[model samples]
Target: MNKKTIITILIALVAMAGQAQKHLPAFQYSKEPAVLSGQIIGNNQQITESVHVRYSLKYTSGMGDALRQTSAAVDADGRFTLSLPTGTTVDCHVAVGECRFICYVVPGQTVTFTLDLNKLETQGLANALTFSGQLSDFNHDLVYATEQGIDPETIYRDIEAKRNMGQLANELPEKSEQGYFHYLDSTYQRVNELIDNDREIGQAYREFAKAVNRYEWGAMMPFCGQSIQYAGIDTDEAYDAFEARLKQRLEVYMKDDPWANPVLCYVMWSMPETFVDSYVSHPVKLPTDYQQCHLASKFLEQMGAQRFLLTEVQKDSVLTFLPELAQDVLDYNERMERELSFVSEQGMSRVCTLPDNADDILATILKPYNGKPVLLDLWETTCGPCRLAFKDMHDKKKDLADRIHFVNIASENSDLATWQRLIPNYIGDHYRLTKQQLQSLHSQLPCNTSGVPIWVLINADGTIHHAFTGWRNVDDMMKEINQVLQ
Candidate 1:
């Protein structure tokens, strides 16, 4: 062969190899940890305020469990590293300061990225971020797809809106089933078109994106035409008939094997408890995938929490159904039980004696910390979001322990024993109030008492500084707390 011809053939061969290598390999579950390291290019003040890169994992157990967070501190130079323990490819929201974006983390791989804080602040688009290393293609594709409006959250919200208000409304039992099915098919086709148009995304990512869309629709399918009020199923007979129809639809849906992919957990994360319970009780045959087994075990784990303990029978059933995950299930149960037992035994120390008078409870609770800014957390043990919030704030609370007086208050609605048991896990001044005392405090405070996880900021001078409900990130809370401190 001529020299030029040989050189051309070699170059063509190399190009073909590069093209083949660009396609991502199929996902394999692993116990090994994944490393995510990155640098934030921004001013020192913005970097300093960005304390931690926080990401949470939701696996088989669902949202009933306390959110499992893996965080790494950002140094003075705006560099951060996180070692995430994931068994499969999972979606995570990597948040630093006010900037947050969805990224996929794969087991046993390192994905490095750079966050341009200036661009994130100015444009508020994560597409400006750059990524490299293993699994970088997946992350890049995810961000690009999200930016282009192919986001799972957006699609889910659109579906929900149509289900609630449009012709696809679950409440409209008389709506044509074929029409609804057509809508789902069209939505999937649109998503596929977006994926097809994106020539940059790999084959594995394309499949993952489509799987997410299918599973999300499957998750919501069981509720179609099953709204109790809309169906007018007031009697037991009618209720039974309605349930049977729903089960039939669900079984048909499950035939597609929606749970085969471990990554579907992302779509299922925000699903309501009722939906999960219905899924677990459905008579459809289970998938043989180990991820499916693990998810089933996690669902059982949540069910076990209803009584605050997993019974021996329940554990045995888990072992029987999920033999592949037998040891894992047992170890998780034992570890959780041990942690609960330890915390329950180590009851919290009261910072001050309760006032004999029940009136003005808020004033009485703040009397001990008159000159220190107090961040009052109102929560209950049975509340999942409340406990999750506490877990999220654990490290942040410790960092501010000396600077702020953290007080936690619970009412009679929460079990006294349970309250004592969990309070030790959160290091703060604890108080259990009577129903009447709680009502009195609510009347005095400006915050909304409609929820359990309420946060009230008490100024150093013993006056209300701020009050809000629900969970807030550490940086946002710090901003308000700093104002009160200054």
Candidate 2:
């Protein structure tokens, strides 16, 4: 090869190597391109504060746990900055204790969040699974899946669409025996017919229970491990068989794939709380010792990255295994944290907030954005009211954007094009986040927007200046913003 070509190839190789490094180390900012500089602040110093946070994918996929050992600390001035994975729809939390907070992450934007302390939670799964709308989706999806016998995605989207049509939660379809799944409608009819007929999915358990009776231990293990929600109609015979089979499943899973599906096992165990109580506490219990609990916690700690499905009790039970796990969970708490400070609420500076790393840009945001009365307008493409509100607000942007930070957040579905077309100027320095990200953001605010076209205004001190929902709330919203800014 010519010298010139050889030199050119070497340069190209170096550039490729540089690009390759970007995806490694997961949350490495350059290695993983991300929105920068998240901040959490506390209003009253005398009142210790705590904030919670989680990251997520917009759709029903999985999420990454974002408590960075290096970036986990809250700041002295009551701010914490954190970096999220590239392409992550991140959620942040703010709370004092068991009470809930509001969410405020930008849709699809790499994030920098600021929250106050009055809006944090410190107990239970309700405190941990900080994603707000996710449960609504879960409940809606479960009921729809049972009724329609369809995949969770289709059911989830159906619920969203119904919401757009302004349907109430009660108005949605319920678990119907005669729907497409149970009766006849789709290719899955035959498969649906084979599952347990009992409403509680106990019928499926009965077959497995009978298998246990016949000493089909191998087959019974799977029955115990399978999703219990799908199980219908529990019986005494079924419960006993489930216990027998599940004991075997737990043994096998704990031995081999303990971390493989921690949430599923926990959920499975929780299915028949009554039966599991009897089974586990049976004369032949799971050693009736804390060591086993330690083992279970180890599995959970190792699998914390994909812990969206884990309940608080499950997470706590596992963390109780080792002191370090408890420390880490405690560490996740950001106290009176500067939304952009170095030390976390736990009083450790080991973890850094988003601003800690990208100080320059963060400083820029805080310079003028701080303490300035700001109005955050949240809307998505799929939301008709959100679109209408966007258009309505768009008419006033010339007067608003320069005075207050008016951000139009695109929901994850906005990328689908169909959702995008409804809104004008699908351009600009817009912040996009998934519903999960939005929910995570909600973990910080005093109030959250259950429906779109919501307005959240905050003062430079991070006090929630005013919060409201609805297009009609716009006038009141404007007044609040003006008062806060003035």
Candidate 3:
């Protein structure tokens, strides 16, 4: 063969090879699944040898829909495969453990990693090891960027400390914006530097991260908009100035979707209720009507029908006022119901009866399990710490099953359907109560704050023995329970 012919044939072969390498099949929904595998090294003697690696895997459907969480499990070392439906981007996390990581997976992809618990706690996973798969570099970038972001507590403290300055309440309108923007700008610069310097990170993730940053920063605007200095005074001049300032501040987010800008959207969503008549023309009363005026509707309009509908659904207020605007969203939800299916392997949870209030709780619920000391787990469905506490206490509950009565009381604000669905995952006596009831019960208990999952221990004599909040480890809980028992 001639030299030219050979060269052309070689070029053609390379092109064909490239095509073959890139030709991944279209996602087959549930027909195929993705796998996540990893090994945990440096497991101390205290840590279980074969730990249950459970995670709540949240992902978005390819069709641009709401996020969903699927419960997944794998042995700490048994390839730790995660089989998920196709065309999803997953954020995986152990209930309370620090194995939180994000990855975009398609059907038939196997993403793998090794986590060193010791290094993970101190140096973070970004410094510990490398992640491998198509989305590995993107995932790594996310970790690196997050590791470099400013600590939220620092900013919170700076803003809050000013409250003691006495002048800060008056200076809030001017000072908060400067402080907020300073931190936000610094965060933006740091993340942008990482993105620009890294070639491995994809353009898609870079864009997404930018959106997330904007949304986070946007949420703080509401606090900045409020006039703490002039708490109850009603002035037309102050009102006009506040409205103008808020409108000016919101220019950046005017075009963004409510979901993408959840914080800002939520503040705007609440404006109607909190600042009623503040938006009406020739407002005679409130001074900050502009902040409440037409902003939510404008945001809803910019979010378009689908996003608006989903936002309303999340607020649990759809079909109340925005039915005309939500026809498309309703249709989309219906379509998803038909097209998607989940095959959950969660076993049947032991059913427990729910009592009405603290009165009924003492009379019927607690009275029934009279002999055993009760550990009241006050939790709600959406509380992250609450979920983590429950997950961490799982094994302890199984071991200490006979010693104590585990009573889980969910706040009334929790979705009843979701509460019922999730209760099966937990082992305990379950009950639901309103905020009024929770406070009434708290007054009678040892707890100081209304926050949950508040642990309230009832002595065998039916008197309050102890109450604490936050994720108290298994050992701490055992010590408390045993102390009460003694």
Candidate 4:
């Protein structure tokens, strides 16, 4: 080829490259904290004043115990800034009153946006309102897609319905394995097309969104099948065929580096026991790169604990599988150990005698701590959320240990042995009541609902200050406690 012809071709190639780069911006990951700052640009005073940014952090697959939350408050002028502790990228939600919308955030970067409460309330549109700074293109595309009727919440609701009702209520014409797989494939293709066709989406976010959609679609089979088994409708032959097909689909999906997205890690970790067992028995060979190896180690660690109690040998076995990533695995485990050391070395168990009369149960339980305010926690050993709340409040409880009396009450529904074994991790005055006694106690209290993890705040003079069900954050709990204390 002549020099003139070669030079012309090189120039044309450079132009093409630049055009492609314009459509797909480069993204770099960092460990530094990411800042999300925004303003409410509407006339809704209630929403602007109450807005908060909250997101769950899942660094590992054992999220039930490992999950942590980060939240930030908005000021009177409708401006708010939240620092997200992330190494890679994370999906977070911006909550205003009862409504919330999703946003993508990365470490060491600032994402600025505005929320129009009027538009959000009337039309339910939470698109950028106004977007700027890093990841503006990505967030705009995400919110745009969601508004156009392609939303993850729709997919999640379908999966949830199948789990609860034993069948798919939307989209699927048939309930068979083939039909379910078809639904997954069709939904995934639609989402994929939406991301691919949008020239506005950056390369990093496009990849992450695709990975998240793929994993969620792939996970539905096992998740739904497990629910069916629990409902006693699933058979060995059907489930085996379903598992085999799912494994095959995953093989193709894994090639795309799906685990690179940390959001997908939450999906993987949420898999049912049956799925985890199947994966352990018939393991798929993952990429041997640093991120892949570290993810594999965390997966095994979580699965081992979920399937059965993990011993030292079992943990060592995880390292053996990823010898090259041994240090990474060790570091993750050490960090997790430090975070989860909620079990107190010094026993905080206080033995309490139960009154014979069913009606006297509440009075007798509160008799010992007469002059001090008491936070009575009604929970059960079998309740997963109850245990999670205990872990979340452990540190906060210690800080307020001297100011107030923290008491725990359980009923016959919780096994005695299990209750005894778990209470050491929960430092408080413990009481196990008979079923009738618990019923009577609930009747006496102003409980909104009959549920576990109920909170009853008693004044120092033994009057019931407040009674409510479900878990509240430490700040909210302290606020209520302080009112009674004053």
Each prediction's RMSD over C-alphas, in Å, is: 7.4, 24.1, 12.3, 6.8
Highest TM-score against the true fold, candidate: 4
By lDDT, who's the top model here? 1
Q: Write the per-residue lDDT of candidate 3 for residues 27-50, one digit (tens) a residue.
A: 122334566666566655313333
Q: For model 3, give the RMSD to the true fold.
A: 12.3
Clash count for candidate 2 is 63
Kindly list the per-residue Cα lDDT of model 1 for residues 101-158, writing each as its tens digit. 7776777888888888788767756555888887676677778778778866677677
Give lDDT tens digits, candidate 2, residues 1-486. 999999999999987754532221211112243333434444555333434444442211111222321234455665554454423222333343443332323323343433333443333232222222222222222332334343322333453465345442335243322221222123223334433343443322223222222222222233322222225436878667655655654444234322222222211211222233333433222322222433433343333212222456755764565442344333332210222132123222121123323324323222445745556656665565565454345435545545666545555756645443322232123455555656655555556557776677777785676677767634754666668767
The window of 10 residues in a row where model 2 has the poorest summed lDDT is 21-30
State the weakest 10-residue window (summed lDDT) of model 4.
Answer: 20-29
Q: What is the TM-score of each candidate against the true structure?
A: 0.61, 0.26, 0.46, 0.65
- Scored by CA lDDT, what does every candidate get? 0.67, 0.39, 0.52, 0.65
Find the 10 residues in a row with the least total lDDT in model 1.
58-67
lDDT string, candidate 4, 22-48, tens digits: 332322235587788888766655454
**Candidate no. 3 TM-score:** 0.46
Q: List the residue pairs that clash in candidate 3.
A: 36-82
Output the lDDT of residue 86, model 2.
Answer: 27
List the candidate numbers ranked by TM-score, top first.
4, 1, 3, 2
